[model samples]
Target chain A: MVTEIFFKEFHTPNNGIFLRIKDSLIKTRSKFQEIWVVETEGFGKMLLLDGKVMLTEEDEHIYHEMITHPGLSLLPEGMRVLVIGGGDGGTVREVLKHNPASVTLVEIDELVIEVSKKFFPSLAGSFNDPRVKIIIGDGVKFVKEAKDSGFDAIVIDSTDPEGPALALFSMEFYRAAKKILTQNSFIVTQSESPFYNKQFIVELLKNLKSEFRYVKNYIASVPTYPAIWSFTYASDSLELDVPPKRKISPTKYYHPNMGLDTTKEIVDEVFGCS
Target chain B: MVTEIFFKEFHTPNNGIFLRIKDSLIKTRSKFQEIWVVETEGFGKMLLLDGKVMLTEEDEHIYHEMITHPGLSLLPEGMRVLVIGGGDGGTVREVLKHNPASVTLVEIDELVIEVSKKFFPSLAGSFNDPRVKIIIGDGVKFVKEAKDSGFDAIVIDSTDPEGPALALFSMEFYRAAKKILTQNSFIVTQSESPFYNKQFIVELLKNLKSEFRYVKNYIASVPTYPAIWSFTYASDSLELDVPPKRKISPTKYYHPNMGLDTTKEIVDEVFGCS
Candidate 1:
């Protein structure tokens, strides 16, 4: 008899993606969530948290570059950055490309970092740079207790809006994150899929609108994710629609011509705006 | 015991999407290929050909609008259009929105049209329009036999590049399509996924480039498809990079601001162009 092993993630109770795995590289329960590393024939190595795909080697550049470049591009050089819950270091890897003064990554789970360092060294290598500071703690608490007006930008690269990462999606968290940002600073977060998570995206955008002077939503296609993945950009004073401050080279997805603007029509349709 | 039913499509030998089905609406073998219509929990009614998803009720707007508007929006009003292999009438539905003088749709399978009339009335309703002409025949043969300089635009809304639809993606067919188009006319075709069908897209774009003076590629997110879906536009003299000739409204996905421009970076990466 032939044996079959597959990893599946359901975006809705009824819809999702499945991948045939060659072998399980690692499977263990972390302090915060269940973690699994699997090798696949098509996508190379994949990292999953709580059975949800976090990143795969083949398409991780699209997600990491998209999450970092749009926000960081508007800011001046040597900006101080904060990344919450990106234990795998892909966000930091992209941030470092912008010549940041510093990047402080606060991740609750240490095991994810260790696993990524072992399996995804190119991404985890960002931790070795002297400009990056790694913090193993609750991101929400760190933001609330941090000194005010310190960081220039905040990137919430957490998991989906559930489990320990649930607080990261709340308005209260957005307000707390705002307190630590210098004037003209921005906050960007993964706003989930527009197709499968419409309710979540609408609610999250509403919360961001309440907390910021300008709130915009942009999207990129991450094939491993549920659908077209969305991102929320919130800022107080930065001009949202302008060319990047400078060119950051060596990117596969996020180029200056790439359409990273907030698609207002999509927002209007989702919000039922006439 | 409770039983479960699923509709699954493998994008590759190892990866794909699956949706929970409430019930199979219809299953039949056409003269060309296998056809199945199943009621899905999240996606509503879905049509499958040869065990591959053709479209779903919930997100079909994205695919239909993207495939039609980008090219049609550039053409002048009262222009003639030809659509190859779009039996379901969704492409015709969008083409009519452009106020074309007339549309000629050549689809090989008559049953696909019959099924669409029964199951997807809104899409098939375009067939009732006096300006639209439906032809049940091979699209390749029809394009070959059609009078020269007849159509202002041609939309190839065919299945995957296999089985009965394989000829549609070939250069021989594209050369024949060009013969039927008026000068300054354009041709657009659904070119499959950028991630899953990279080889096919590269090959198709190369063929289009060989036949047309200018060829470009654009992409849109079709959640039910394998990944981010791609489309190719080929033309002789139409300026591809200007604002659409006119506003085609009441669209959920295609607006003037939507990034329909050929993303050269993606093409460069796929073609290994420096």
Candidate 2:
């Protein structure tokens, strides 16, 4: 007897790596397109293009908060930030929350910006802020032209090692970053989930490890992404203005005190997996 | 610009209970049909029903390893066990690994038996044991009738509270549970996540306070479940089994040691929510 069955795979948001499994099967009209989205089902969507995960939805707070605060928060403080590939604009929004001098958001995809602005209202707020500058452009080429700039912090919110992000994962991009960043600048990017693409993440971490002494992997829960994703941070100086335990106000995400506490779990999962 | 957006609610399977959440428009492609079969854009599909979350493409051992081992490891002495609503019986298979005396499986749906025999090869092993007794009937009603029918432990593996479970979450259900067990019988059910669900869980716990002397919430990380959906254990006379500090077994879902350490966090979230 032949019957229809459901085969679902949990995957990394960055590459096509996934763990596929069966959830359920029913003989009926396919009324709904999807089954159900549970907390354990894992967040972050995986876009496998030519057998590679293109994007995983990093937790809105963990990745955005980490990418923005770690460097911007350390600036003694800076007012302006330039973001590349964060068409989602979540990182940009986190940057402006610090009351930055200004934010320049250079995104290649208008659709991503449109989607983030629509679906993720809290994240899109960064683009709407007067202090934010939304510029639709290529980050790799842009970084090269903006060398010796005085931006307080520069965040790379690109996708994984595909599309426009191919160059961002390379060292030339880091060298370009060094050219544009301030004396004690910070830089971070989506490093992908460890479960599906540990090799890719390790390679990225290794390359960054070779380039910077302060490169570190910070983890966070992304229910949608496979194995939860991590962000890689790199900088010249060790001294950073760690984000306060609490933000100036309340947030649905990013409780000030939890900022440092969540890092421990990140370290455990990372090293344990390693 | 009058660009419209959509936010859809989904009911995902977490063991038995449904983990509900509202997702925004970016999730245009459905993950799966409503039968707990998830079909995401790039990750393909997975079946998440029958209280077990196994990848459809991969073997069921991964999810089975975590779901069964964690609870069993906490109580190495468990012998006589009763599985509520496990018609497919993968859980019993995992339980049998410890070499228990007998396993009473109460499945409400008859089709589950027919389907399990045909589709699920790994799970069918649970029913093949000589010590296993299959009862095709209502778990809640049968349990109510099993007065003084002491069992070493009970695993509640029912479907979500859609229809059959309408009575499982009531005062009468727990009332019946008190009668069908020995003193040290540890009863564990799939508790909802503390994240998107605080108020709902608080109400359930509030009700349990009057029925059981001790009730504790524990969590396991399952990608299908957010932050790993929680589990609640209730006891009347004997001390609840404590979780191991380290995992003796290599499990994709749980290691033995995360218990008690995370107790405070789980308790705080459950109690603090209300």
Interface RMSD of each: 2.3, 10.3
Off by over 4 Å in 2: A1-83, A94-122, A127-138, A141-155, A171-188, A191-274, B1-73, B76-81, B96-104, B109-114, B126-137, B145-153, B178-186, B191-202, B209-244, B255-270
Model 1: iRMSD? 2.3
Grade the docking of candidate 2: incorrect
Top candidate (DockQ): 1
What C-alpha lDDT does candidate 1 achieve relative to the native structure? 0.85
State in Å the error of residue B179, model 2. 5.7
User: What C-alpha lDDT, on a 0 to 100 scale, does residue B27 get in candidate 2?
Assistant: 17
* Candidate 2 lDDT over residue span B2-40, tens digit each: 212211123233212122222211111122112234333
Docking class of 1: medium
User: Which candidate achieves the best lDDT against the true structure?
Assistant: 1
Clashes of 2: 53
CA deviation > 4 Å runs, candidate 1: A1-3, A242-245, A261-265, A270-274, B1-3, B261-265, B269-274
